[model samples]
Target chain A: MAAQKNNYRILTIVSLLLLLVFIGFAENHLDLYIVRILNVCAIYAILGMSMNLINGFTGLFSLGHAGFMAVGAYTTALLTIPPAIKAQIFYLAPLIKPLDQMNLPFPVALFVGGLLAAVVGGLIAAPTLRLKGDYLAIATLGFAEIIRVVFTNTQTITNGALGLKGIPALTNLWWSFGAAAFTLVVLLSLINSSYGRALKAIREDEIAAESMGIHLAKHKTLSFVIGAFFAGIGGGLLGNLLGTIDPKMFSFTFTFNILLIIVLGGMGSFSGSIISAFIVTIANEYLRFLDESIKVGMRSVVFSALLMFVVLFYRHGLMGANEFSWERLFGNKVYQKTLGRWTKRPRKGGYAG
Target chain B: MTLDLFLQHLSNGISLGSLYALIAIGYTMVYGVLRLINFAHGDIFMMATYFAFFGIVTFRIPWFITFPLVLVLTAALGMTVEAVAYRPIREAPKISILISAIGASFFLENLTIVLFGGVPKPFPAPTLFTDVVQVGTVAIQKLTFYIPIVTVLSLLALLYLINKTKTGMAMRAVSMDQETARVMGININHTIAFTFGLGSFLAAVGGIMWGMKFPQIQPLMGVIPGLKCFIAAVIGGIGNIGGAVIGGFILGIGEIMLVAFLPNLTGYRDAFAFVLLILILLSKPTGILGEKTAEKV
Candidate 1:
């Protein structure tokens, strides 16, 4: 067992080194389009993982990620846009007082955006977490719509439907990958800890978890807030990457895209989410041809069809709530049994001869 | 506001409210039987308009023949949606079914967009419904009168069906306990399909009337109204037909009055439904007319 543990440790170290090398190579060698796609994948990975934290790990089934993303994106955009740009964008209606004068570094703005989204998540979760199943989904969906509508109407702050432009294109592959990496590390550690166990217990059986002395509300809120925080960061990164954002950009369709990633990945597996995020982002870009040749709605139709197929045929998704572990793969009894059968067959044949 | 203006708003509100009521009934009935929100319900409503549009415009069919055909086709489409998207996952987890419903809704919306294009098309409003009737200083469309009468008649018919029909009893039993109903020899799938058919029928009627009154149709037109009507169903007590109608009227009138009273906030009209939904969820999760039922472990 100790030897197995040592093997896993070495494998993890090797994988990390490989990933770092790949990132470095891609940064130097990849074309602009490929780099842009990679940045998008990294951002989507963060969003997918965050959504998985709430809906998969915690089993909340919340649909408010887009709203949280909107908050984060708008906050970051407002803070990072130069005063001159802000002035130009808010020509129809003057910018809000403090925001008009404010300009912060990209990192600080992104952090603040995430922090505000977390605050909003906490506020929303306080009352909403009491509900379960579809009610919770609808409520969260409603909150997301409300947030969108507010953004659309609030001319002074969000510039209404005109949207903010000239945002600094600061979200390179390094920043996006770095943020996604941070999210993965934090989320993986959290999921392995006692709190994660408590969350799983609640997901398995709420009454049983409560009887076991777990505070349901507290743990649920923590998971939700944490999820919101990362989702916010993802949104901020997307805004910076795009260099332009409007209220229309953060519609329920945006939430649906992230939901598709997590659902395809396997709801409860962090590694699965990371893998699926890249697959989905690339698939979306590749599927642009279908949209252009056929109709704009073809891509969405294909995605929704895929979602239904997954839900109906493979409820457990690709990973089935299991993490990828090299140790487990090599040490599997099924693998050993198959190997034994193969080796024994030749010897048996020789004896017969 | 002057009494004359208030009367005009009142008439407009009632017309909109009755249309909302027509749609909400479908939501409540389907929820009652399936315990599924049927996210595709809205898209089904959207398709109904498209069906009518095609019948009248593309096929050059007269209104009298086209309207009934649209309703029948929409009903069939609803049942097909259930059979295709929902029936396969009837025994799965509730969340899976919900996701499937979302998928189905997405599919329908996008398919319409693909086939019909995204641009808004003007509905061929019959001269009869679009004619303006003047009373004192108020001018209202003839639909304003016809819609409420139609809503009341439909409500009565629905109530009669639920109370008097064998299918209604089966629906109630299935909703109460599916396993028990199955044991009692009720064809659960058939009843669910029938419920969807009925809901779709009502949605078709509502959609037709809505298109005529508004005279503009688009692929995404059903989304907001569908959401608002769902909110109305929730407010009135999901699964209760009368409550859905009442909720619809309340929501409709409330929305109009809010805009009238605070014109500056007209932009936030869509947000109003969600705010009301959140408030209702927080304060009274069971809704106004919803009966409390304990979860059985």
Candidate 2:
């Protein structure tokens, strides 16, 4: 146990050191264009983590994550924009007195933005969580689309999809890492908690969990709200990163991309999501050269074909129910087998705690 | 807006809704049977429109010959998709199939994009079909009339196929209980493939009609309509054929009405479907005609 504790500390330190070095290099060495892309990748990682919380760790199938992010982006944009500029931008309507006058600090705006998104996510969960399997996926997809439309139509609030610009650039490299770190810590704690156990139970077997007296609605809602909260923060970060906001930016494609990340990462594995998020973001950014010559929908064809291949042959995803750990990297065969056996053994079906 | 404008908008709404219903029927039917949301259905619909477009433009075929040919060919293509793309993973976990569906959807869209350039193609709308009819005070194009008629006829035909035919009976059997259907010697694979073919045929009809009505086709055009129709299917209680039609109409009309009433919210038109989707998902996941189903596991 002592050795294991020491090993974990060393791993954490090494990972943090690598991350700091990468960020330092990004900040100093890379040009603004590259930095911007890196920031976008970081934002996607944030969104991916938000999705990973519900879809991966909690075992929920949500396709509307982009909807919540849109909410966050719009909220942050609405809250942080200067009153004079907002009035100029949305000349057709009078601004909300509170929103116009108020411009909170960046962290506060992100927090409130996330909180608002979480509220919406919670409300959505109230009805959607009752659904199981594909129903939930469709429901969430609808919600995401609905959110986009709402932003587009609520011209008084969202500026009607012409998009909100002039958002405060408060998201630096440090801020993004801060949010990512906070999300990772919160998710880690939640996944290891009793609530986490209940969520896992619901994912594995809902009926069995209900039979064991676990309040299915409560735990599911908790996960949904938490996921939405982070997704919203990610959205806010994204808004600041881009320095522009539009409803079109948070479309079904946006949701689909993040969904791809969680699916490609082993579902329910935090480390898997982190790695896959980076992989997917980079692959999409760089791999456009492969099909750049193709006509309008051709790139989507190749991407989708890859997705089909993955689903057909590798349902387990890139990690295949494995977490990123030094032991696997260093070839600790005995520890890996033991960990594998632990995850595979089906527990007796009972109510979630 | 004057009464004529209102009527015109209403006509547009109905035409749009009818087309949506046509596409939604396919999605709802497949969802009913396989419990898989065929994401590729939208791409298939796009491909069908291209088939019709190519049949008319490339082959220089008349609408009379092209329309029927497109329907048959598209339906066959859909079945082929089922055979090639989805067949191997039928027994896999539902999530895997769902992912495969997404993949297939992307693959088709991208492949089409690569094959057909991204520039929106001006689909051939025969002048005869484009002729405006002044009915009472409202002036409407012939295609507007054709859209609703085609949608209704297809819906009737689909209803007949499902309710009054042996194949429909097999489809119902498979949807309700696949294991029981197989036990009863119903060919699960055949029925599923047939369901896809039938659905694709409807999608082709919608695609062709959409091309005629909008008269502009792009590879990505099917994405929004496909999503909206899926919402319609959900609202109509997925798997319920009649419900899919109703859902389609509601979605189509509601969107136009939203834009008409709140002209300022024209950009919010896409959001209307999504908002309705969330509302329906919240209040009635079973949809208007859908029965509630809980997994035994």
Best by TM-score: 1
Q: Write the per-residue lDDT of candidate 2 for residues A139-254, one digit (tens) a residue.
A: 78878877777777676778876888888787788888778878888888888899989988988788898899899889999999999999999999999878888888898778
Candidate 1, residues A1-353: lDDT per residue as tens digits?
Answer: 46647867898899989988888989889898999999999999999999999999898989999999999999998999999988888999999798899999999999999999999999999989999998899999999999999999999999999888999998988899999999999999999999999888888888888989999999999999999999999999999999999999998888888888888899899988999999999999999999999888899889989999998898888777988787465556786577645532323333431
Candidate 1 residue-wise lDDT, B78-163, digit = tens: 99999998999988878788888888888888888888899999998889888998887788888999999988998899888888
DockQ of the two-chain complex in candidate 1: 0.84
Whole-model lDDT values for every prediction: 0.91, 0.84
In candidate 1, which residue ranges exceed 4 Å CA deviation?
A1-5, A328-353
User: TM-score of model 2 relative to the true fold?
Assistant: 0.89
Cα displacement (Å) at residue B19, model 1: 1.2
Q: Which ten residues in a row have the lowest lDDT in candidate 1 chain A?
A: A344-353
Q: Flag clash pairs in model 1.
A: none
Q: Estimate each model's TM-score.
A: 0.96, 0.89
Q: Give residue A28's error in model 2 in angstroms.
A: 2.4
